[model samples]
Target chain A: MAKTPIAFSLNGMERSMFVDPGQNLLDALRRGVGDLSPKYGCAQGTCGTCSVLVDGKLQLACITLAEAVAGSSVTTTAGLADGSELHPLQRSFMDNFAAQCGYCTPGMLMAAKALLDRNPSPQRQDVVEAISGNLCRCTGYEPIIDAILKAAAFMRTRGRP
Target chain B: MALHRGRGFACVNYPIGMNLGGDPSQALVHSTPDGKFMVTLSSIDLGQGMKSVTRQIAAETLGVPVSDVYVDTADSDTGPHCMGSFASRGTHRVGNAVIRAATEARTQMLQAAAEELEVDAADLETDGEGGIRVRGAPQRTISVADVAVAAQFKQGRTLSGRGIFLVPPSEVDPETGEMSPVTCFAHAAMAVEVEVDDETGMVRVIEINSAYEVGRALNPKLVEQQLVGGAWMGLSHALYETTEPYYPDRDHLPVDFNTYLMPGPGDVAPHNIAVLERPAEDAPFGGKGPGEMCANPVLPAVANAVFDAVGVRCDDLPITPEKILRGLRANGS
Candidate 1:
């Protein structure tokens, strides 16, 4: 298979790389782009560990073809932090002890970011529904749900994204 | 259509560290020139907070701030030997070794500080804030950083300690077939409530109340997280997850998470936890460890809850709806 050039904006920066035709976006991001935050877990897309934001939409990088989403803006958990300051979601997750092993954190953060971006104030059920695709083997989802709700409140009070 | 609600309870006792082949964990604690300390061990974290807990243990033993201690659990090639992390033994086994090593290092640090101050080593006491002061005079203090510099450059004393924790092997009595396999045991009890739909044969867990005697919770939050995650794993094993649908015949094997069923956030029930402290005599900081014990009582509790709700004993795992429906038909309900 011949390698094709795919250009996209990642974390507010434009990046271009030659990717294998059959390679998924996850491999393109991790190997080509050197973005290790979006982990390669259950590459079949069941674990939701490879979740990323493509053009403001929640997409699984493992199943998404590299060339299919060319020129799209991709956001990962690494993009959640602004320099030294962490995002409200990340802060709330640490404060509430949401993550245990930290393996499922990137996906959970992406899923929560997608929800909060759409609805600034979401109900508990809505939060649950948003991260339903992501599986966390630690913290039992209670702390994760609590952290998302608390992050929503924090973001609402700050009146900023 | 009638829905039956039922409750069930189960208890379990799990040993902290197995003594098979002499369970051993080794740790090396050394001080840097900047007063910071590093503990190197081969025990893997496995997301159970082994690094954090061992750092805490070492800091407490060394009479320093927890942040001053850095635990390196990188790889077995560089660090000292450990029996690996499993059987809920990291905290108990590795922590004990860390305490021993940190204690020896602390003694060496105190001696160096005493030499720097020209005072008796026994007259010096650590302030737990990286300061070594005279026992009676709080103002007469020397910073640990200054002591470290003097110990290495002036006194030529290397402030380092090594420790290895091993449970003595107990011989089994040939006639009685009795032997203590581990140093300490952690205990847990769980009560589960479930709702069963007679027509659909679907079982849903409503609530769970669990109590665990973890000996000591080094980090209470970590302990609770382990328990909650473990209980969810139990619920998944009891009602949802199954690797072998037709045993002895490898057909329809699940290759993905969608095919291999696991509990999601929606399947999670309300869990109330009560942590009891029953300190172990020989364990580190009296912590017998509670990692693996969290999932032990959940399986039997959920199984018994299903039996109570539908009056059917599911001897097999993953008491699926199909299994419950067959049990209901057999009971002629």
Candidate 2:
């Protein structure tokens, strides 16, 4: 199989890696770079577990080709927190119990965080629309909504840095 | 949501939706304005045990007798959701989490107290919120509040506790299409009453009532919430939910909630008060899942209810207008 050279910035680090032609960015991250936060759920581009922030925009890493992200920035769930201290949304997910069987968390967090980062104080419907692609069987989507709202409230309290 | 067709067939089933391998928060150890926030989370509260196990573990840890603790399973990262998604092991999984976290806090408090008093940690007793009076002394006392504060300096670390448990929870082999492939069963029984339209063939939902063996109710209100939520989800799977992905090989036809055909308030019948029966072997406070369980029987119950209402036994799911008409035709009515 022919290989393609790819270059991208991940979690604030600039790096270059050779990816197989059939490999998606998610595969490269999980297998090549050793980032396991993004899971292999449906691999059908349906479940949002493989979501990542591509150049500040939420995109499915499972579908994006590794070669397409050259010079682009990719952020995974592992990039969201500062060591053990979690992101506000991550912390609120703990507080509200938003996630269960957290396979969807990486994508959910990425999507919700992207929305929140773009619009710090999103309304309830906004939160709903934000995570429409992610599927969570645990919290019944209620606490997930509550956590986004709670995280918004927290961000507002913190002046939304 | 599984029905055994044959007699004497033992079944163990895991929930279909709950994928066990992921990280969510289960316990939070922090000092509140008036007290400490010590929480215990089940695998995933998912609107089921988010708040209940919090209460049970807090009550157990503080020795406040389960009344004083308040749980919120609002977040997922810091807590743990269960091994799978059945809404049946809410108590078992979260109860174990509650035990682990609360027990950790309990040990830390008693050990800290022992350190201060220069006695064996084994000799001390805990009363929930650091209400540690001397085992025999009438005057010697250590309030929960004080131990919590002192623990910050003594333990040299945040006293947060966490436990990750994959209970395997009723294994239903999706690959093989096998249900009840395990030894654990969080059984629930449901009943519903419906009204079917003969002319237009529209079966408007009338009312639904369900009962589940919840082992024990850590939070009774949460159990009701789970049942209500599960009932709605089950309704979709039975009557509206389709396992078949929409056209276009990858695009989920049910892309949005609107097309997903999930039940709204208008489409849903009033969740008649669901009765939660307590089982013995669940947890410290006897809690189990009610959300997913409540949904399992909804389709069948509605089908059964429709059969009762219109004298038709529909084998296929979703008892839609077409299915109802077919059911009517099959019944020769």
Candidate 3:
């Protein structure tokens, strides 16, 4: 298959890469740009492991065409943390042990970020509805919810509106 | 303690000629002969973090550092035979065997350390770093790693320990379908509430309360993860996971990320989750398996919850809107 030149900003860096016709954004990112945050849990997008932000909207990269997001900014999990410093959600996730095996963390984090970006002070119900699709087989939602709420508190104190 | 599988009495203590039903998990541990070390099961980590917990159990028993207690899956070619990890029985059955094996290893290390440090073997306490010493005597210490290197692998001493625990075949008459040796039992319970759309018949699990008897919580955090994971799986089974349309034509089935109908941020219950853990006596860590326990109740739970809200008892794995609507239509609701 002939490769198509797709331009996009991954994480924070503006970059362009040649992608195969059959390649999804996930494969293109993980295989091409060397970003390993968004994992391939269920390639069918149901598992939410390959979620990324395309133009600031959460999208499943595994099924998404690389061409769809041409010239769009893509944000992956790796870009969330500032070097060794974790984002509030990531910190809360670790503190609450919301992630285990961590295969699903990337997608879950992205989804939650999208939710918070939309409604930073979402109620518990809103939080549930926001992350309903991301399946985590390890921590029952109790901790994840707790972590999210805690992150919200921290984010508020830090003036992350 | 030998790690066994299934619901007691039928635990197979020996490995099979062929992989059983294509279970990808395995047990891992190294043991020595003289009934000193025991390798109970393979190191098949089910994302429960029991692998590290198994090492903890082994190290604590052997008086070695958690790191010194290296674990590996038994080789079908020439290793001790036992059922590999799966069915969430690692800590229950395998942890015991690992304890037994490590205890033997510990004893030898202690005896050697005692003799070298001029202290009673009982006077020494094992450390997580695989070292042992008298309570107040820092200088009087011996490392289990050094002992293992000198005593087993290097000296060619048979570091062989064996654990074979099979679920006892039910003593009940086979003709009557009764069986025994009922090695152990694990129980779980779940309570869920779902909101059903009267128009759409869509059932959304609104709240879930769950409790399980885990022989023990080897890794408290890890087990919690299992509970969360199980709940999600249950949720998936209740609403989205189905093997229908693309069944006969496997290729047509939901493939890749886009086509499948899976619960997402927009699909989960908003509030209420209660998780309780009950310890088990027979389990090596007093934790029972929580992995599948949460899932088993999910289908029935959501269905029952939906029924509570909309008055329907769905008799299907996934109580999809179609099934609920059908149940409603059959009942003329």
Candidate 4:
């Protein structure tokens, strides 16, 4: 397979990579770009562990084509934290014990980020619907829901510091 | 067709560890020159917080702050032996071994501190705040860091200890056919409420109320997470997941999360939990691992709830709608 050149802004940094034609964004980012935050849990995209953001929209990296993401800004769990300080979602997750095993955390965090970016104040049901695509075998989805709501409140008040 | 609601209850007494031949786990605890402690083990966490629970156990036994200890789950080549984490044995078996190793290391630390203070080793006590002091005199104290520094540089002593725990196989009486395989047991009682639709034969779990007796909760947060997640898995097993959908046929097996049915976030019901602590005699800090048993009671409770609602027995797992419809049609409802 001949490699196709695709360029995109990843986590606020411009990077270029050569990926095999029809290669999914997950494999391209993990193998070609070396950003390992997005995990490959289910390659079929049923499990949202490979969730990432393409131009600030929730996209499943496993099912998405790397070529389609050309010239688009892609955000992942790796981009959530700013240096040593954590994002509000990450802090809320840590405080609320929202992660176990942590295989689904990157996806959950990405999904939550997508939700908070659009709806700054999400209700419990809204939070449920937002991350409904993501599957977590641990935490029972209770604490994750709580963490998302908590982060929404913190982000509304603190304004993303 | 109308929806019928019903409630059912069930209880379980789950054994702590596997009854296999000498289920054993080993641990190694060592202190760095900077006073930070490292606990090495071969047991895997597997999302059950085995590493966190064992770190807490080691820190408590060593009389040091929990942050001062780091748990390293090393490979078999580097770490001590452990009968891999399963059957809820990580907390109990691995915890006891960590306590033993940390205790030994603590003793050595106290001896080195005593040598520095020119006092008897028996007279020294760890302050649980990174300091070693004389039991009676508070003024006579030395930091654990200073003690470790002196022990390594001057005394040329290595502050390390190794431990292993094994529960020998229980002897079975040939005539009576009885044996005590497990030393302790964790218990649970659950009541589940469900609504069954006679039209579609769909079962919706309204809520779950349950109590667990996990001997003791070493880390309540970890225990709570396990209980909560385990119950969801139980619910998934009871009403949703099945490897064989067409029964007795090798075809039509689910290969991914979409084809394989499981409870989504929307399908989660309200769960009310009450954890009881009746410290076990032989458990480490009187704590049993609440890893596997949290899901046992839900399976039978859900089945019983469906039986109460539609008066049909679902002996097989998942209690699929097709099975329920067949049962309802057979009853001529």
Chain B TM, every candidate = 0.97, 0.70, 0.75, 0.98
lDDT of 4 at B196: 96
lDDT of 3 by residue, B1-333 (tens): 111111101111211112233222233345443223334454556566656677777766665456445565545565455565555556666666666665555566666556656778888886666566788877776665555555554455533333333343334465876544334555666677666776677666656666555555667666666766666776887777776643555664665545556665455454333444555555565655554565666666666677667666776656777776777788786
The alpha-carbon deviation from the true structure for residue B216 of candidate 4, after best TM-score superposition, in angstroms, is 1.4
Q: Candidate 2 at B111: error in angstroms?
A: 14
| CA lDDT, candidate 2, residue A47 | 73
Q: Whose lDDT is higher: candidate 2's or candidate 4's? A: 4
Instruction: Give the DockQ (C-alpha) for candidate 3.
Output: 0.40
Instruction: Give the poorly placed runs of model 2, Cα more than 4 Å off.
Output: A82-84, A118-123, A153-158, B1-124, B128-133, B138-215, B219-229, B240-292, B304-315, B325-333
lDDT of 4 at B118: 100
In candidate 2, what are the lDDT values of residues B176-248, reduced to their tens digit? 8765432235566666666667765676666665556656655665565566666667766766765444323
Residue-by-residue lDDT tens digits, candidate 3, A49-137: 89999988999999999878789999999999888988999999988877766777887788889988888787987778777768775
Indicate which candidate wins on DockQ.
4
C-alpha TM-scores of all predictions: 0.97, 0.57, 0.72, 0.98
Decide which is better by DockQ, 1 or 2.
Answer: 1
Q: Report how far off residue B304 is in candidate 4 (Å).
A: 0.3
Q: Alpha-carbon interface RMSD of model 4?
A: 0.7
Regions of candidate 4 where Cα sits further than 4 Å from its true position: none
Worst 10 residues of 3 chain B by lDDT: B3-12
Candidate 3 regions with alpha-carbon error over 4 angstroms: A1-24, A41-47, A53-60, A63-75, A79-87, A113-142, A155-161, B1-43, B64-85, B115-122, B127-131, B135-139, B142-177, B245-260, B270-281, B302-311
